[model samples]
Target: MPASRDQADRTQRVQLPDETGPVPVSIVHAEPRWFGVPPPLLLFGLAASLFVLALVLLAVGSWPSGLILLGLSALLTAAFLETARRRPGSERMRAAHSWTSSRLELAREHAKRLAEVQGLRGRRAVIESERRS
Candidate 1:
């Protein structure tokens, strides 16, 4: 077969069956699964509760201890919020890394298959030339 015909055959699209009927999906990728509420919300809640407890301490007679608790709560809140902000980006990075690695693996497999085909073609061409000579 000619190269153009082979190329067209490889480029042909296939339809897949789904609940919505036949869909022409090319590249299949899925979003990462979420099991529960994000950690940041929980961390912020904890910080808020701590701040309330510190206020209660201040209302009572422990000024030194209340100040300490308030400072700690502030620190925890800041850390948790920062972590929350970076969490999505980091998760996305990991997902992107996984996607990139999979693509590389697919490319490698395709290259190997193409090399095998080219090797067979070269052998066939050599035989044809020998026959003609």
Candidate 2:
């Protein structure tokens, strides 16, 4: 029917095993951009590579090139550190990490309480059985 076709055109539906009928889900695509700056890890990797190359050059007696590369590597490393410090999602990442740690602590405490309760229940059951006997 025209109504069914219109509905189908408006929303894509998917059949789920746990659902009674088709569910419509909206698809979304998000693109992440670094605002024209290279990722900190990439810069760090380049810096490390440069440092290794500099060491190799120095071992091969290329003192001038080696010194230059060494300086460049140091500069790149500084830039990488600065970028990583000022990255947009760094605070969010830290917050998420702290939140996860707190949640883990809470879960651990809950588990400990549950274990104690289970142990007490088991002891009470044993005592009651002995009394009955």
| Best model per TM-score | 2
**Cα lDDT tens digits for candidate 1, 45-67:** 67778889999999997989899
**How well is each residue in 27-125 modelled by candidate 2, as lDDT tens digits?**
997756669778776776788899999999999999999999999998886676666556535665445445544665897899999999999999999
**TM-score, each model?**
0.38, 0.41
Model 2, 117: alpha-carbon shift in Å?
62
Clashing pairs in 2: none
Candidate 1 global Cα RMSD: 32.3
Q: Report the poorest 10 consecutive residues by lDDT, candidate 2.
A: 92-101
Cα misplacement distance, residue 64 of candidate 1 (Å)? 1.7
Clash pairs, candidate 1, are: none
Q: Which has the greatest lDDT?
A: 2
Global Cα lDDT for candidate 2: 0.77
Name the runs in model 2 displaced over 4 angstroms. 1-34, 88-133
